[model samples]
Structure formats: C-alpha cells, structure tokens
Target: MAHRYNLNVFCLPSELVDTLTPRALVGQPPPREPSPPPPTVAPLASAKGCNICLGATFADVDEQRVHFRTDWHRYNVKIRLSGGNAITESAFAQLVGGLEDSLSGSASSDDEISDESDAVNTLLSKINYTSLSDVPEDGTLKAPLTALTWFHSPPSTQIGVYRMLFPLDTPPSAYLSELKAMQATVEGGRKWAMFLVAGGHFAGAIVRVGRISDEQDEVVQTRKRKPPKSKPETEVLEHKTFHRYTTRKKQGGSQSINDNAKGAAISAGAMLRRYGEQALRDDIRNLLRDWAEDIHECERIFIRASVSNRRIFLDYEGCVISKGDGRLRTFPFPTRRPTQAELARCLQELVRAKVSHLTEEALRAQDEAYLASLPKPKPLPAQPALESVEKPKPPRLTKEEEIVREKWNRLLDMVSKGRLEPLKAFWEREGQDLGGIDALIPEWTGDRRASILQVAAQAGHDAVVQWLLFDLHADPTTPVPLAWTKDGGMESDASDAEAPPAGSRRTAYDLARSRAVRDVFRRCAADHPDWWDWFGIAHVPSALSKEKEEERDDKKKQRRKGLREKMREREAREREQERSSEVVFPVEEPPKAKKEPPSGPQKLGGSSGSTDGIAGLTPEMRAKVERERRARAAEARLR
Candidate 1:
C-alpha cells in the first residue's frame, strides 16, 4: 500500500504553531517592555500662575500649553498684555519710574545726552526763581499760584517762581486735617476743589459749581404761583462751573517744609530737625505720593529735586496720571513758581490766546485797521429804465394740414377696428398721395410707431395683412414699433423670447410668423422651418405639422376609449336594475290577440292599363296579405 495522509488532520510543529498564534492567545505577552517613562517637560521661562483664570497653573511646559488653550486664560492674557486692565497705585508708580530709568540708561549716545542737557538748561533759564521766605502768609501768593492766566501763557512766560512757607514738622495727619477743612468749606458753598500731591509738592484746583436758569424756568415758576396743575411743572436748572482755578506751584525750594518757626510752629521745626534732612525728605515724598494716589486727579503738580555740589535744585512739572495704567507722564516744560513780574507776562500771554480778552478799545483799533485795508466802495452807475419786449409765439397748423390730420385719425380708427375696406379707401385717397404704405403718418405721432401692416398683423386681420404685403406691395420687412418689439411682437406669447434690438424694429414676416398666421405663410423654409440655407430650402417638410396631427389622433383615441368604457359601465348598471325589478314584479304576458281571418281581400289600385296589383302596395304589405290568403286556403283544404 502507498503512504497515506489525512488532509483534514494536517498539523504543524509546536514551535511553528506558537509563532503563528496571536500574542493574546499565547499566555501573557512578554511582560510589555516597561514603556520608557514619559519624558519630563521643563517649564517655560515666562510661565507664571494665572491669577485671572482661577485654578489655572502653568508650572511646567505641558501645563502652560494646556492653560493657553483655554478661552478664559487667553482672554485675560490679551487684556493684561494690551494694557487695558487698570493697575494698582503702587504698580503705576513702579511702571513709570522703571520706564524713566530705562530711558535714561538707554541714552548711551553723545548726541542724545547733549540734547537732553541743552533742553534742561534752556528750561532753567526761562524760570525766575524766588526764595521761599519772600512769599507772604496772607494768601497773597494764592492769586498767582491759581491764576488761569498762567495755564494759557507761553511756556517761557509761565516759568516763574515764588517762595511759600511750609512747616516741615507738620505731621501727615495735620495736613490731612487741613485738606478736610478746606473741602468742607468749599462744599458748603456748592463749590468743588481737588487737592493733588506728588513728589513732596501740593497743588489744588477749584471750580464753582452752580445751576443756571433758562426762560423756561421763569415760566414754570410763574405757573406754580398761579395755579395747582394736574402735571407738576418741571424746572430744569443746568448745573455748570461758572469759574475754575487751575493751581500753579508757589514754593521754589528743595525742602518743601519749613524748619524754623515760633511757638506752636516750633513743634514742626523740632520734628523736622529730629528726623534729619534726608529722612525728612523721604517722609514728605511718601506723604505726597500717597495723597496723589488717593486723589486720582487728571492734572497735578510734581516737585522733583536734583543735587549738585550739595546744593538742591527744585522744579515743578505738570503731571497727567491716567487712571487706566496708572502711568504718570510729565509736561514738556517744567516751571518754577511765579513772581510779581512773571504774573504780568502770564496775563499778557493769556489775553493773546483768548477772544474774550478783546476789549472795546482793541476792537475799535481792529475795525479801523480793517477799514483802512479794504478797497473803497464806488457809487452805482445811474441808468434809465427800459420797456419790456414781447416774445414771438409759435405759428399754428394750416387748414389743409388739419384736414389731413383728421383723415389720418380716421384711418387709424379703421385700422384698429380691422376694417380692411375702410382702410383701403382711405389709403387710396389721401394715404397714397402722402407717402408709401410704410411711410409714417404725421398725425400718428405716438410711441407705437407701428405702420398699418404691423397693426393689422397684431389684430390677426389676415386679409388686411395680406392686402398690405402682397396686394399693395408694401415692404413686409418694415420693422415694428419699439413698444411692440419690447413685447417680442404683439403676436408672440413666449415671454422668454429674445428681445428686439434697441431700435426694436422687426419685419412683417416675423410678426406674421409670431402671430401664428398659418394660412398666409405656408409651413416652408421661408415661412418658419426647422432649418434653412441662403441658397434655397434646406429641408423639404416640417415635422411640426406631422407631430401635431399625431398628437391630435392620440388624444382622440384616448377620448373614444374613455367614452366606450363609460357606456359599458352604464349599460351594466341598467341591466342589473332591470334584473332586480323583474324579480320583484313577476309580470305575466297579456292575452294573445285573436288571429282573426283577414277582413276580406284588400282591393288593389290599377297601374294605368296594366294589372299588377302587388305593385301598388309595398312589398311588406303584399307579403303579409299573401301569407293570410295562403293560410285561409290551407285551412279550407284541411276542412
């Protein structure tokens, strides 16, 4: 026997089977290679905890990446970076100081340093500085310090100094009390004042707040006094600031505080000496900074000092501290306090800047100067009045033209009514003498511009159309009027057809074809064909006629079939009713009529001389009589 193998029982070696099997099926897969532990991610350099997006921390690169993707974190980041968010008072000061230090440090070029020094020297030269001891204590310095004229003055004229006495030993609390008292005093009079202190200097701005009455107020008051009205009279008093005082600095010294005084003022002096000069300066600067921060004024004065050769140089610069970023920016020109002489210069500059400063004398002088510069007016030349002339009138139409117009109007009426005979008669008389059939009639002067042929075609007057085209030999190619062409010819119902040219003229043949006048124009290439050529007729016959006929036949056949079906249904219903009635009535036939012997033989009329009696009667009657006679004869024979 030959060696045999079982096909179904074929097997592989154990190792081969193991290699072919999936890892999940073959015990636990080789213990996984321990996954290498995820690589550590380091934190970004600028990463910080997000205070705005609560619970968001960016301690590492991965955390920062995740946080940046959040909408809340992104929004806050944008607002902060854009400088739209308000900063704290301390942050504002720090930011401004840091910017200034950066600017100063970055000025490494010689040109930049020289420009800054020159600017400072020029500014210092314009200021008239006075010792603080020279200022009087009776509020005499207040006028110059708070004068609006100084604000309007030129930068040069505004630069001046006056001495003011500040008791240095006065505690910050005392200063606060004095400010409160001043505010109370002003508030009682419906006035407002803002006190700002910065860099150890104090500045105050005052404005009188009150209401003004309009004409309506007087009317309302009178009405209230006269009667008690249903509706309360409303008096609208407009609140306004009648006067404003923008303060200027009056002190001109590095030490803003006074160290020597008598009696109670002695306490302030002793306190200053005890604190030491540097310590005292630091404390005063801190106090002023705090006051400025609290007041939050748009305009304020800042006093800063520079030391050279152990001597102090004090200056006052106007500062604008925006509430948003708390950034403090100084005015370009720094000025010292104003002196008596400087006050006069400030007033002069102020007058130049305002129109209200124009006094009556100044106005008179300006008027005189204007008059001198102007050209002298000359007297008008005398002239005599002239009479009016009449304008020429247009000439009217002659009697002949009027008659022609009447005849043309009659022709138009005939054309509109499709009266071919009347139109022909009219044309024969005046119409032919005037012009050709296509010639426009002067009386027919409207937008239609349609010739007689076009009107006939539109009215579907086939006879008139034929007469105008073939009989009269009128130009069938004459274009239709604009109005008709815009409507794609009066005969055309196809709204989507191409519009006629701007002149909107179309030939008579086109109009006829559009109107579907089949009799006048045969269904040929020249008429309306599927295809045509310049030489002659390209196609012999049109498929339109054949298609239409076939369609008609199909419709007729369908109608006949529908009628036959309806007839058959009606007959079936009638037969069913008859069967039911027969079953219910059970009708019996009437007694058969007696077959009486025919009453004698019927006489027949002669046919002229011949005796053909059967010829006189119809075949049916003769056959009936003959049958009766034969039956009688048969009966007799039977008897």
Candidate 2:
C-alpha cells in the first residue's frame, strides 16, 4: 500500500479495528442525514460540516467557534495525537458530566485537563479490548530487520491508500444490502471484524457500522500538536544464515541469477516466510480464542490472507472460524502485510460511510494527470523485410541477436564478477535464446567484445570454467581477441584495457589467471583431448593429465603439511623456553670448613681407644670426637 501517511483523514479510528461493527439496518428506516443549507444561510452554506465530530454539523460560524473552545475538542485532540479517531459528540455526551459540563469545560494543558480527560477515559474503559500482542518497541511501520519477519510483500503488489471520506448520503437499506452482499446479516451488534496475518504480523478486531449525521457541528479539528520525535537509533538484527550473502568469488557471472541461486533463496526465504506464517497463524488463533465470545457476537469476519496462509488463520486445527463459514470473506482489493494499521485501513475502505468530493471534471482531470504521469510505451523495433522469393521461413528470432538492452549489461557484468550457479542457470534456462553454450562464447558488448569463457578464465572463476567446459562440452582451445599481453597470468582486468591489436587471439587456456582455472582446463583437455584443434587455438597441451595434476597437487599438499608441522614445532619450543626463563629460585652457599682438634690428641686416643663408633683417628676424626665430647660436657653442665 502507499507508504505515506494518509492526509485526507476525515475520520481516524481510536483503534486499528473496532470491537464491534454496526448492527445491520434491515427493515429499519434510514437515519436522517444532513442536507445542504439554503444558499441564503451564508455561514453554513459554504461549510461541509465538522470533520472531527463524525456525525456533527454546525448551524453557523459562531456555534462552530463555540464548539472549538469546548473541552470535548481538547479531549479528542489528545486522542488524535495519541493516534486514535475522535469519538462522536453523542458518545462524549454519555460522559458523567454529560454534554453540559463537557461543553462548559474550558481548554487546558497537560495536568490541568485531568478532570475533563477523566470523563473521556471512563467512556473508553467501558469498551473492553484484548491486544493480540505487545506493540513492537520500534514502530510497526518500519520493517523488522530479523529473518523472522523478513517476508516483505513485493513492491506494487498491494493497493495504495491515500484518503478516507465519510458521507451522510448513504441510506440504511444500502448498508443492509452491502452487508447482505458480504453474506453477513444485521443479527449482532458485533457487526464485522477485520483479520489480517502476514510476516508474523496479526491484526484482528470487530469493526461496527458507523454513519455520519447532523449534531454538534462544533467538532473542530485538533491542530498545533507536535509530531512524535524520531528515534535516534533503530536496531538491526543480523541474518541467521550465510546462504544469502555474495561471496564474490566468481569471475564474470550474472549477479541477479547468482544472488538468487535458485533453490538457495527459495528454500531460505520460504523457511522464513513459513515460520512467520505459522507465527501469524498462532497470533490469529490466540486473538480469536481471546475473542471467541466476541466472534459469536460478530455478524461477519473479513480476512486478508494469501492462499497458502489463509488456512493458517481460517482453518487451522481447532480454529474458531472455518474457510467455508458464511461470515468469512476476503478483501476485494489487494492488501499489504498484515498489521493493525493496515487492518484499520481495510475497514475504513470497506464499510465506512464515504463521500467522494470529486466531480466528473475533477475525475477527468485526475485521469489526465494519471496518464501524464505514466511512462510512455516504447515503439516496436523494426524488422528487416525479406527480399528472397524462396518460401519465407517461419519467423523466428535469431539466436545470434543480442539480448534486450536492459539485460545486456547485467549479463556482461554478472559473467565478469558473479557466482557460478547463476551463469549455469542462465544458460540452462535461456541457453537457446542466448545462442546456447559455445566454446568461444563471445559477448559483443561495448568496446570489449571478448569471449565470456575468456573473461571467466581470466577472472579466476574455476567453477564457471568447469561448468562451461564439462557440462557444455565447450572447447577450452576456442580462441578470441585477447585482452591481455603475452604475460598471461600477470594481465590486468580485460574489461578496463583497450582492445587488443588485430588478430591477437588467445584460448581460455592462455588467459587462465589462477591454478584452479588452469586445472579445470587441464581436466577438460584430459576428458575430451580430441574435442578441438589445440594447435590452431594457441593452446600448449599440458604434459600432465588430470590424474598427474592431482598427483602433483597431493605432493604439494604433503610438503605444505610438513612445513606447517615444523613451524608449529618451532613455536612450541619458543613458548616453552619463554616460560622457563620467566621463573627463578634462590641458590645455596657451600658448607664452612671444620678445623681439626689438637693434632696431638691424648684425650681423643683415650675416647677413641674405648670403642664408641670412632675407631682409629685420622686428624679429622679426633677433632670430630673432641668436639662431640665438648658439646656433651657443655650440655651436661647446662642441664
């Protein structure tokens, strides 16, 4: 739907969807509607009546001015600022103070108006509400960044909403007839509900029939309110899957096709959308259960869900509503993602009394403006007339004819700098139209009319090279004007370089920029050695076939493994030495020398001759014995 805020908002509901729809008006006389004032009544004649008060009109400017000054207008202004529709004057009159106090009350700010607000608050409290879920902390209008809520409906798929109008011209019978057309009746006061579910967003509530009438014409619009402040920051949830990212590992390839990668996005997106669908279903079921009693009170249920998601809300296990329920109906127009605001808009567009201000002239002008705004259709391309008298061949578009200008650059760029799957898929699906896979797939684009295979090989796209040579049986020896000099692997991007000199041709083998790409060409040659004239194409046949290449790769891998092991061993040794040097301990001193006792040892001989452990005395033994004897004597004396 239109992403902008609606401006011609003649009526704004306090809630996205009401708790009740209007009671059907079967056999009831239409409510009296306001008619145009006589031309002589200048004050009222020019006025279309007060928009704030849904069913109110002013007799004159003085009355309108008086109404503007009342507390009711101030109360509605607060409500509108809070993102709610204004209540009717009659509804306001039901307040405890009634219309008397309401009209008598003066405009006040903030806290000063508490008493007046209390009355309106009490009236609101009477309307029981069951919120399906908490309002997102960030406004729901902003799409959530999480994969859980990533299923944004494609652009231009939904109908846009611009304005809402309330008319006094519709009759009671007309409302009843409309209800009848919807297979709903005037049986319950809980008229109809709007249930919407998409992308984990669910909004469902009963909306009652509401009509405009003449009453207090004093319903003045709320003005001068400051708009809500914008948040300084918004949260961005990171993707839970890596499949959606572009590795940019490929050389030249179709990015659009590569980015999608067929089954990858379809499955990933479907998974996310499926989760949201189930979540939405549960939310709808929860709200329906919350309003089970309310649904019994409802006359009809308006649902906006796609075919796949419809059953989730309408016919899931133990669901209150069924797909075939007579009360069930779908929106006539396209709808946006299921949110409370969208649900409210649907009701406003569906059943609210609307007045079209556009006359035939205005409509005509609108049509002309619309036509003027549209992009003009392009003229058909001219085809050459056949001069041959031979029977005209069935008119078939030439396979050699270039693709549409819109897609030409995309294809060129994609092949040059995209993933492999897209290039393979593009050829698989549109190969015939794109002139099928050729060994020398020439792209006569811009100043660089080089072969696509040459671009792929030069860009280090081994996967694309493999697919082309193996699956398409493309000859690696097929040559084209080279973008590089004879340096081969040292060449710069071909797309940026000037065109080669006349007849400077090279095969994809010559342009191979990486070992992986060369390996692919080698494997292709090994598989189909006789497929192309290698000599004419300037391709030097490899001495090693695919098996020999693999053997060489194996030996290189083993050498790399040995080098990595040695490096790791050296690092470990360095770390160990560092740890040992970081620690220190105290050193011990050598023992002091003990002096020999008297060399002539008579006492020592007497003690030594008596066979204690000391037998023959070396000079050292006699000194030790003497010292022990002296120590014992000292110990005996001390004791």
Candidate 3:
C-alpha cells in the first residue's frame, strides 16, 4: 500500500497578510524555509502616542503634515535647534516635510504649510491642548472635552489637507488598502461618511476594520444585567474594532466670503419686506379690537393709512394673532397662492365697503370711477424734505406738581386721539426724562384713556392693567365694578344657568362685552355666579339667599365641631365605665358586714340558724368540732 498524507495550503494578498497574519509561520514549514525578510525600520512618521485615543487624525503626503505623533499626541511637539538655537517655521516645516517624503513618495516642502493658512491652527490657539498624561488609559474619552487640536487648523477652511498617524501593530497601508479593496468589491463604494466642521469644511474617510468578540456581542445584546446567583449572560469586551470603511469628500464645502455676506443681507431684508402686508392688516384689526373693548367709554372712530412708496395699500383680513387675554388666533389663507385677479377683486371689495360713508349718488359715481381706476392706480411720490428749521424748545414746568399734570394730560391725549403711526415716534421725540410710566403720565392715574384701555384690551397688554389699576387707582366699582354682578335677581350671560346666590356677585360682564371676551364671561359666571344673561332668560334656578349661604357656612363649621365633641365624649365615657365596673378584691371586710358576721355561725346555713342553741346541745359535739377545726387549720397552715 502507498503512504498517504494530508496537507492544506493557503495564499492571501500582501495587504491582507500584513494585518491579519503576521510574517511568522504556524504549523509545519516546507523543507526549504524561505529566508527571513530583511528587518525594516518602523517609521517614526507612523508612530503615535498611545494606541487608545479615538479621534480622526490623518497623514497627508503632499502636505507633509502628520498629526497624532507620540510627542504631539502624548506630550508636545517642540521644534529645537542645535546649540541652543531657535528653529524658524521654514526649518520646522522642512524637517517635517523630509520625514513625510521619506515614508511616503510625495512632493512636499516646509514652505508649503503655515499656521496662517490653517484655520484649525487659529482655533487651537484659543485652547490648551491636553497632554498625554491627562488622557485616560482606556480608549473611552470623558466629557466635556477640555480641548482638541488638528494640525492647528480648522476643518472648515484648509482642513482635511493634512493626515494623521497612529501607532499600531499593522502598517497604515494595510488599513487603507483593505478599505479600498472592499469598496471596489462592493458597489464601487459610491457613498462615504463625511465630517462637518464648525467653520463648515468637510473631510475624511472612516473605516471599520474588525469584529467585536463573541463575549462583547452577548453583553451588548442583553437588555439588563442578570442576578448574582444566575450565570452571567455576557462578558465585558476589552476593545471594539471596526470592520468596514468609508471615504468622505475632503474639501470645498465651506461657504465663500461673498456667500456669507449675501445670506446675511437677505435675512435682514426679509424682516422688513414681509412686514408690509402684515403691518396694514394689523392696523385694521387693532382698530376693530380696540373699538370692541372701549364701547362704554365713548365709541371712537379709528382709521390708518399705509403709505408704500407713497400710494395707499389695503389690508383685507387683519385678525389679531394675540389678545390681551393671552389667546392666540391665526387666519387661514388660500391653500394655493392667490391669482392677480383675486387679489385685485379683494382690494376693490374693501374700497366699496369703505366708500359707503360717502353719499349714495356720490358713492355710485365714486364707485364707477374707482372701478375704472382700479386697473391702474397712480403710484405715490416720495415726500420732499423741507429745509431744516431751528427746533422749538419744550415747555418748562416751574412746579414739580405741574410736571405730573402735564404728563397725565399728554398720556390722555395720546390714548384718545394720537395716531398709532406717530405714537412710537412721539415717545422717542419728546426727549422725555421720565422713567417708565412715571415719565409718561405721572398724574393722570385715575383712569386710563379709553384709547389706551382699548389698546390694552385688544393687545392683551397686562402692563397696562397695572397702570390702570395700581397707578390710576381706578376703583373696580367706580363706573362698572371690576367684580362680576350676580345680584339676587341677576341672570348670567348664559341664562340657562341659575343666578348666583343673592350676594355672590363676582362676574366681569361689561369687560367681556367690551372686549368681546366670550370665554371669560362663561367661565366667570359658572364658578363665581350660576346665572348668565348671554343666552336669553329661561326660568333658571335662583342662587341661595345671603342668609342661606351664611347658614351653609355655619353648618359646615358645626359639623366639624360635632365630630370633635363626639370623639371627646366617646373617649371620656370609655374611661368612666372602666373605672366604675372594675373588679375589687376585698383586703378587709366593711365595718357593717363585720359586726353582723358573728351571728351567722349556726349550722353553716345562709348564716340564718341559731348557733347558741346548737352549742347548748352537746359539749362532745363541740369538742369534736374543735378537734376537726384544729386538724383542718394545721393542714391549711402546712400547705
């Protein structure tokens, strides 16, 4: 029979062998052992500090820049010259360039790189780069981070140009080549991971190189830890390695100088341009809301003209977004942008509505003219500036008391008749030397002008509330009480509900009516009073009478007192009964009982028979009885 042998042979690419399988052999060797490859010097260019730091560090051949060296990463990189000389930037770059070119075949010079050119360098100047000793021994990094440095450059600018090196068992190419090969194998690797810098630059390629251990997989898979008695489901992993790689575009992602400027300008312009339509609409809605709020204080007409370029603009729907009540409202526009004809029609409708104030025949004629002119309205011309004239001096008050009066009058006038357009300007133009409302209206504190009140109510401005209530000392009941009125026969706004108890008056009807605040009216009545007049009166139940209300309160107090009294009585009765029924063992007989006891010796019967008669019958009997008694007494004494 012929001799039989089993053998296995395998061959892999140099890059694969460089990382996965060391040059050393395993198992049996061939009869002709291959000579050991020449010893190669580990490149200083490839050496990094500790292999634990997790950061994106690169090494670029063209830039001759290598980040994450043993010194730079672990300690610090200092350029030193021989004989106590200081090295220039050019010299330092030259040395770095020479080292880089020696390790990798690339054209680079010391003069090519500079701190000025590197944005990361600029940022790094502001931070203190932590030394290697500060870094934790384990790979995990703690936060918040103290500082970070990358070629002293910002990634948003001249970033991604430099590359980094980290010390590891395998050569850097082993990692790079493997990633490239995998990409070629899988869909040509079209997509890569990209990094975004604060300055806006993009760069780098990320790679996954290896799998986590089976032990790590178990730990990571568990939802929670097991009990101490039970077997552990997983083991802690010492290291995590990547198994895939990705490349990202390294340059040209940050904004240009001109682009930044243009963006800022556009943002500012939007603030002004967008307000044109909004301002007109807001002015109109404000008027309506104010009118609703101040109907009691004489109703006043409000009108505002919007000058655009110079022509008057119209606003169709200017509903309020925020009310003094802190409510928010939004108007729905057409789902799609409106057509020109639609916009024109809307404008014409507004014009017709306002023109009603004119005479009927005149209105008709005006309407025809307006309709005809609608197709082409004349544009407004810019106002001409008159020659500058000497400004007049403001009035001076001799008395401080008069000063307050003047201020009060001014605030009243502003609220009642001042145009909204000039209101803000007037406030600034006065060169007023007052602080807050004190400067505005020191004395007109009795009541806020209807105009201001209307504005406050419409705008839901609570500061106005303090000014009116506290500063003006406007009594709630002066005109219409601030409290809701729920008298004996009163009905709530919602008549279906019962009236408040005879004296439980606390509603805000007029305020609600003037402000058109519907919700407030309903709520205030429901909790404070029971009746409302908002709905027509139906026979609603009347609230309790004042006496009845008081009785209810008194009853509540009485019930609590009764409970306390009952508890006290129960405790006292228990103590008294225990004392009265307690069993008492007699230590000594009572005097009355002791005196009568000698007569009860006869026949031992109910202590009723005559003991003297029995004693006379026989001495022998007595002797026997005495002997028996002596014997019993002896026995008792012994026991």
Winner by TM-score: 2
Residue pairs clashing in model 1 are: 132-163, 160-336, 160-337, 161-337, 166-258, 168-258, 169-268, 480-506
Worst 10 residues of 3 by lDDT: 153-162
User: What is the C-alpha lDDT profile of model 1 across 1-639, one tens digit per residue?
Assistant: 111121100111222222221111111122223223223334356755555444344667777656554433433344344332323324333333322122333223446445544322221222211112222222122112222111111111111111111123443324323222322222112222222233333333322222222445557878787643332111211111111121113643223233222232345544453344445334433443554533343222322223320121122232223323222222223434323233223222221222123333454465455544545433222111101222355557899977877777787678767798878877888766667777764634552645776666666777776676556755444555444663443445535566755433454444553434434433333433432231122112232355665786799999999999999999999999987864222222224454556787755763232224445767776666566656777887999
Query: Ranking by lDDT, best first?
Result: 2, 1, 3
Regarding lDDT, does 1 or 3 come out ahead? 1
Clashes of each: 8, 21, 32
Estimate candidate 3's alpha-carbon lDDT, on a 0 to 1 scale: 0.31
Which stretches in model 3 have alpha-carbon errors above 4 Å? Answer: 1-531, 534-546, 588-639
lDDT of each: 0.39, 0.50, 0.31
For residues 1-639, could you state the per-residue lDDT of candidate 2 as single tens digits? 223233212232323112113321122233333333322322345553555555456777877776675657755655554444566655555453422122234444457555544545543333211110112222122111221100111221111221111112444324323332332222322245667754344566665543222121223213324543322111111101111221223342222333456543445645554454445556556667877766766555677765655766665677888767766666766788656567666766654332223333454465455545545433222111111212445545555443554345555677788567777666666667655556234344542424667777777888877777777776555555545454543346766777755435676777776788887776666667687654345374663486797888899999999999999999999999998865222222223454577676544342222344444557676666666667777887999
Quantify how close model 3 is to the true structure by its C-alpha RMSD in Å.
37.9
